[model samples]
Target: MDFKGLWTTIKKNAIHLFKKARKAIKRYIRKLVKHTKAGDYSVLIYTIFALVALILIIVMFANIFSLGGKKKSTLDITTTEVATPADVTEDPQIAAQMALKQQAMDIYSRNKDFIFLVDENHPLAEGYSFEHHTLNCGLDIDKRIYNDFSEMLNACNMAGYEYNIINAYIDKATQTELYNSAVAHYVDQGLLEEEAQAQVGKSVDKPGCSEHETGLAIDLTDVEVLGEEDYKSTRGTDQWLMNNCHKYGFINRYPANKVSVTGVSDEQWQFRYVGREAAEFMAANNLSLEEFMELVQ
Candidate 1:
């Protein structure tokens, strides 16, 4: 029965029991008075005991009904089901997307320490150092990622793409010099030192802020396109590298479209190692390092 109907029934039964109890008490009182008047003290004692037992029975029934009602109410509340967004059957496309994201997260969790951010806004900590392996081309990269980098270069060679490593793993002093030189070039054009620095900042990251300081960034160029005025052009080897770098745990650190977000102009040759899974995730989503960091967080 519904809670309200059951409660009504219990109330009616309780009222009937109370009425009967009251009638019995009244009868006992009358008997007690009669027995006292007749000088029968034993009958008076028996009537008093009977009245006490009847009251105890009434109290026990009241407690049982009260407890029953409470338990019913509690059961109704506890067993009630509430629908939510998560309960719906997931779409196949969405499920596949979620699986990919979970896979990326698993990869990220295993390599989060190595997949760090270093940009104009996020500088490397002072005294930062890493075990590094120098490539046969004389460029050094973080030792932990050497195998992946080597594999990538081997793949590029096998694909018949001719390229040269222009820069990698710059020390703070060298980065400072590069920064100063860029600023000097702008200053020679009659811009004030501060203005020149501001202009240069868009292209050259200031000293400690450079990703090369972490030994995980590399700059490359097609052998034919190395001396071009527009180094940002993705011709020949640059095109191949940009298209396939993610497969080997590298990302084009600065894409032309993400200039505003990265706070640096695009260098099509610039690539950074962020591990295979992260690179693939970023590539798939068209995310820069800054954007990827925000997304995972």
Candidate 2:
């Protein structure tokens, strides 16, 4: 398909994401409503938080789908109606999704012309919640995680394998550099600049949108840090790390099997620190970080 057709497909998929979020939120509220109906004074705060969460979802999706400057009447109406917390309970699903358009752009990176930019205003800031940790591999991760991660590294070393921290905790500027470089590469391959930018979006998340900014995500290798070519070629498998990393609180952030939900290609070397408890749960259930997050939080 052409760009427009490809974009339409992307948008359609993005809409599915919004729907998924809407349903999940609705399910959460259903459990809380009983306490709310009984007027449990303490539950009021949770109610407010849920409403705020709904608003964040709406606003984020609105920016993603409507970035092209097209006047989306559905979102406009939905935003208008849900003016306050009171409106969320009135029509949970509609209020939840009134803002997300019928598109998926695979939140990997939005496909819409307007959504090409990252929603810097979205609830999660790149690594805003994680503390910094300096690892001996010459890379820094979220603080306090060094112990668990180091144990994983040490296990690899003991196995007569060496590991390299390919990248960890990139800042927005570095993300911009990677993004621009990817776009340039695509352009060199003969794609139009705009298409190249979108293609870049598919892989290199917008500067402020990358999870690596949080220091919880890391790209590693079993051999010396080589260029992507070398990294790919020398990507020796340290089964000790893969099978046992989750025991220490990391998971393959984007596994090949979950590409449909993650919207990114599999990177066996990429891992994210979700904590041991959550990691175990995720691994046990065969869930991706995205799915686990949707369910638990």
TM agreement with the true structure for every prediction: 0.64, 0.53
lDDT of candidate 1 over 132-250, digit per residue (tens): 89988888889999898888888888988888898899999999999999999999999999999988865788999988999999988787764537675556778889999999999
Q: Candidate 1: what lDDT?
A: 0.84
Q: What Cα-based lDDT does every candidate model obtain?
A: 0.84, 0.68
Encode model 2's per-residue lDDT on 1-297: one tens digit a residue. Answer: 399999999999999999999999788777678677888756778678988999999999988877778575776677766467655646867654432212121321331111111223242443455566676666778776778888888877876787777888887778789888999999999999999987776567777777777777788777664655554423445455677778888888766678887777736678887667656756776877666435433
Best of the candidates, TM-score: 1
Candidate 1 residue pairs that clash: none
For candidate 2, the TM-score is 0.53
Task: Tell me the lDDT of model 2 at 88.
Answer: 60
Error of 1 at 203 (Å): 1.1
